[model samples]
Target: MARIKNGILGGVQGCIGDVEGFIRNGEAFIRKRKKKSTVPRSVKQLANMQKMSVIGEMIHSMTSFVALGFELISKNQSFSANNAAKSYQLKHSLQGQYPNLNIDYAQVRLSEGQLPVAVNPIVNLMDNGVQFSWEIDADQSYDRATPRVMLLVYAPALKKSYYTLSGARKNAGTDFMELPDSFKGHELHAYISFITDDKNEISNSAYVGSIGPAFIEGRNEAEDSFKAQNDDHKDVLTTKSIEHKDLLIPAIITIDDIKPEKVVHTKPNDRFDKRAKAVMKRIKK
Candidate 1:
């Protein structure tokens, strides 16, 4: 094949008109002609070619593989770039080539790092339930990609956790979650993770730490009542009381009727007074 540069044919074949095809720049002038080679390449040559192939794969997998002359600012940035590069390659590989590639959460988190930032989540005590808000590192003016916020709320007392996701079209930037009455009183711990619009990227997660009901003691009468009840009964009914009708019934009794002189009161007695009173009342009747 001869390359036609400036109307001049270059590269040599075997004969004159035997130049069966010609190529100009990248465009082929004619159909491709196959040439047969009888001599086999040396083992060293084949090994070198295989090594170079892997090198190319590594380069393609590196997110920070600048052409040749450019420099990057930080090593951490370079490392993250490399991860991004590897992720993109994996994504491409799985699209049509390899459909069975295992792209799980760990891989996605390592590669894309696409999650948004959750900053200064405020857990406010409210009257009816719990109100929460967080500063999302998101903007309404840009990006067609919607924001998704996920929360994992746990109550140590309940030994259970609740998982939730933001609604469709909700911007996480100024988003908030209003927990139902089930979250009231008992201390709760929470953490948040974010997803951008494409669902292909995610950000690192942030722990909101442990937060009690928005209605803390002295904050409101309801909270004060909750604390008073919790104090009087060490294993007081938690917010889960909503699930059990019997638990929802507030304790109703009067220790004021007990003649103070008739009973010997101690620290333990003070602590178990309610229980003892209930037991004694049951026994008396």
Candidate 2:
């Protein structure tokens, strides 16, 4: 009887401990739920989260190798660090002459607190080519002193791409590019980017949607032949051949003399005379 009473006490103690633990966890959860955020997370803030951290880590790792190379080159007799610095400046100077914007993120900032202006391109389909136009007034985010446009056109079916550069001022209204006949019936996609003259900063690419020639049904040679031969008959028709060789075109036959299916032995003088008399009456009238 004493052992049974001890067992009951042990069960009661275990239930009390579990109840206390549950109460503490519930209170902590309630406290967390009561905490309020000052501002809701914005799209840009969410996107920028960990962006700088990853970029800084990548730059740090790359700079270590680049710095070591530069130090070793500084000690070398053939190429010094001063020479490398001058070479780098010269290379960028040459690049400045051209609208050289390969990667979109590589674009440098123009001024303090300035970012690339988003551009909306108007893609037009022409009879023989395609045209691109954008409203310069819409780009009010950054100051564009001298603007350069990069147009990229791609044909997925043809697996071909064409890109060109145009000055925003020169092509004020619209810019046209002639497409090849092979681009017919294939979908073409276009993207446009702008570069600033002072900073050579490239803007984010704006997808202009699919722009290309209209879909045209090309003539199928095999279908054409089959349709022509089987138009009015159910029998499978074969191309005419002289012997066993297939001919592109059948030979034409011309006969000078005509033969009737059944020749009548009756005299033709009576009919000829009646036709002559009728002709004379009409002429006299």
Best by TM-score: 2
- Clash list (residue pairs), candidate 1: 63-82, 114-202, 115-202, 115-203, 125-214
Count of clashes, each model: 5, 0
Worst 10 contiguous positions by lDDT, candidate 1: 65-74
- Candidate lDDT (C-alpha), each: 0.45, 0.44
lDDT of 1 by residue, 60-157 (tens): 42222221101122123423344444444345422211222222222222122434456676555456543456754445444523656655555544
Evaluate model 2: give its TM-score.
0.34
Question: How does each model score on TM-score?
Answer: 0.33, 0.34
Candidate 1 has an lDDT of 0.45
Displacement of the residue 269 alpha carbon in candidate 2, Å: 25
Which one is best on lDDT?
Answer: 1
Q: Which ranges of candidate 1 are over 4 A from the true structure?
A: 1-112, 136-141, 168-172, 180-182, 213-285
Residue 20 local lDDT, model 2? 21
RMSD (CA, Å), each prediction: 18.0, 23.9
TM-score attained by model 1: 0.33
